[model samples]
Target: MIRAYRNHPYHGRSPLPQTVVAGWLGITQAQLSRVENGPPLVHLDRLTHWATLLKIPESQLWFSLPSRTPTNRTQQIAVDLLAGAPQGIGLSGGSPTTLKATAHEGGGTTDRRQFTALAALAGFGGNSLFDALMLADRKAEVVGMEHVRLASSLVERFRQADAALGADELCDVAMGVHTRLSTWAARSQYSPGLGEALQSALADLANQVAWLAIDGERRQQARPYLNDAITRARIADDPREEVRALACLSLLVREDHPSESLHCAEAALRASRGWATARLRTLLRLRTAHAYAQLNDVGGFDREMTKARHEFDHGPHEDDLPFLQFVTAQELTGIQGLSYLALGRPARAAESFRAISSGPRAGHRRNQVYYTVRLAEAEYRCGDIHSAAQTGLRALPEVRAISSGRTMRHFAQVKSRLDRERSASAREFVDAHGRAFQR
Candidate 1:
């Protein structure tokens, strides 16, 4: 891991010298070498701090860090129940390094699948984060555009953090931010203009939180947040926010309800027309294409994909929304590959997926896992067993590092396919990662 970080492109094309790497890690090169070559470093605090500094995926670590659940886990759950707290509510410690959707008291099952921050405030008792937010709210008499601007900045930070850390470490934090923002909107005094801005920001935050939930595979928990975003967007008369929330909703539902997802895509497209940038329109079109692919409407899928690519080729403009900045050519290529795979065009999908490499998308862990899984699946479908097995193996590190249900699903699909094939490499891959892939 230390050597890999030294070779990471963020440093340069060539590996950095040991001294340089050590400097970045705030250690002497000798100490760094000893740590790497010496007996396994048993110091937990140093390990955790270095992992967090290097942004290593938690799943990739050799040992577990401290659990994020309350110290008295069973007691916490019991208190919630006795207090009549809504079912499936959970809390996260404020530290980014420790952020995670903890398991409930006794069970090994993680709470992300069942718990969410929908009623997060119910668990706020004696929490410093809650207290800090409450103090900030009390100190502020008037809400203004400045607060909205600050929140908008925070939303971007949240998005960046989500991309780097995945939903496991980010969803609860984002949910807390959304909760505080919601409280501020309701409780603070502001002019009509400022109020609309605040609500728009809140809507944007809700959309982010909803995305995090979706990424975490907390779909049921995500629904109400998306709906709330839509309501806030409408109240603020912000069509862009509405389009974003609707587009995300479409993505969340595409696998289960293609028709409903199509409706959401269409509604978002209608709202985005005339005002939205070409990139925004492209994203909406691609989302529509996904719904078509899910419905097995090849013609509809091809048509929308064609339009999406055409719009994408139109390039960036100054009017592009800030949130749409991630809608890059790489993202489009990857999505096109996914749609093609869904449409039963594995050959075409493989070709498209091949265009996505870690070059430009480096440091974006979620994208790496997602695209790698998609590529491996496409390869497996194309009957390139060796390539598929190798690709799947390559993604294992990142797969273990992050918590993304969507990525896990694709990865498991490929793994299952490989298992059935029973090729030597396939069997080896399965056997090697059996524990990690276990539910």
Candidate 2:
């Protein structure tokens, strides 16, 4: 660990003596010697104090500790966490040399102890770090848009940890930071990279919050965030991100505002042409189909679905962005199925749904719930009352857990259709799940 510290650029240029550091920290020379040479417990306060005096971020101090050998269990755990970080969450593990350089660039004195702690926790497979960062960000002392942005990104990583994980707090923190950053960015002079960073952060936060609101049965609440995301994406001048935001808005508007949904989706496709990767193009196409189906445009939906299918059939390479890489054929099939159902093509919808439901990729519970519900709706439309009821039953737990208003609206639509036929099972399912829509 000592060698690692020495090699760090922050430490390499004009290394501070132990005695000098100890004096600055107001600690005795002998005590500083113990801290440097033995199994000494570095108090958090003292660590932060020394970091300030050394003009290095506290994160650098923690990450650059001489005792952080690969053999050290804690340090090894930290390294492992950095190794497997998800995309959009920022850098995880890199070469030690690279980390040292980055720390130097970010101004060694910024105290990101909480980020280090959260990263370490994520590496160790603990979710509590997610909560910790959210809590810390709420405190008054934790200002600085960059720090808040980092915390928000960490929360998003935690959300993507698993489908079942609740990201309410994460979303809330992200929204708060997004609001604050937008205000600051509006007033600040133009900085080369600053505007882009602020725009990206705001867009990401809006997306996260919109997702959470959608999950929590708050479609009305979700709409503004989705719109805000679109604004930020446009400011960033990244058509792919802009289209992604529009896609989200399309989903929100599909039921009641089909024409608007179609407009957003088509605009997304047009804006994203050539600028986006294949995966993004696939998503845009899928969304366009959904919008067309909502407008009862079967021909348009079919054309878009065909294009989307072709794109998904060609799997993304490993080098693709991690976020986009997860958009698989199975997922595309599910979306295609929903589009068919919306277009009143029960047979085609069932075929698409069956293809997805029969796959081994059903491990994704969130997708399973979404697809199952769509299948149930399609079965009802096809007059397969028994199958529809059974599928709805299987999807009930997920629906209740997720409690999305849009999902409940879909459920209600299916239930109303089934009710006309006096299907007892459908009635029961509605009785149990319909209350979510009231909120």
- TM-score quality measure for candidate 2: 0.61
What residue runs in model 1 are displaced by over 4 Å at the alpha carbon? 1-146, 358-363, 435-439
lDDT of each: 0.69, 0.57
- Per-model TM-score on C-alpha atoms: 0.67, 0.61
lDDT per residue as tens, model 2, 1-439:
5434534688667666767666776766655554465322222223334555456754654323222122233222222223222111112343111111012234212224433433353352353332233222222222233332343444356445324433332333334444444444555454453455456556666676666666545556566677677777677654444666787788777888989988888887777664355677787788888888888888898898889878777766422333453477777888878777777789889888878777775535555666777888888889899788877777777776652445666766777776676667767766665664467
Clashes found in each candidate (C-alpha, N, C closer than 3 A): 0, 9
* lDDT for predicted candidate 2 compared with the true structure: 0.57
Q: Give the TM-score of candidate 1.
A: 0.67
State in Å the error of residue 40, model 1: 59
Candidate 1, RMSD to the unseen true structure: 17.7
lDDT of 1 at 406: 69
Question: What's the CA error at residue 167 for candidate 1, in Å?
Answer: 1.5
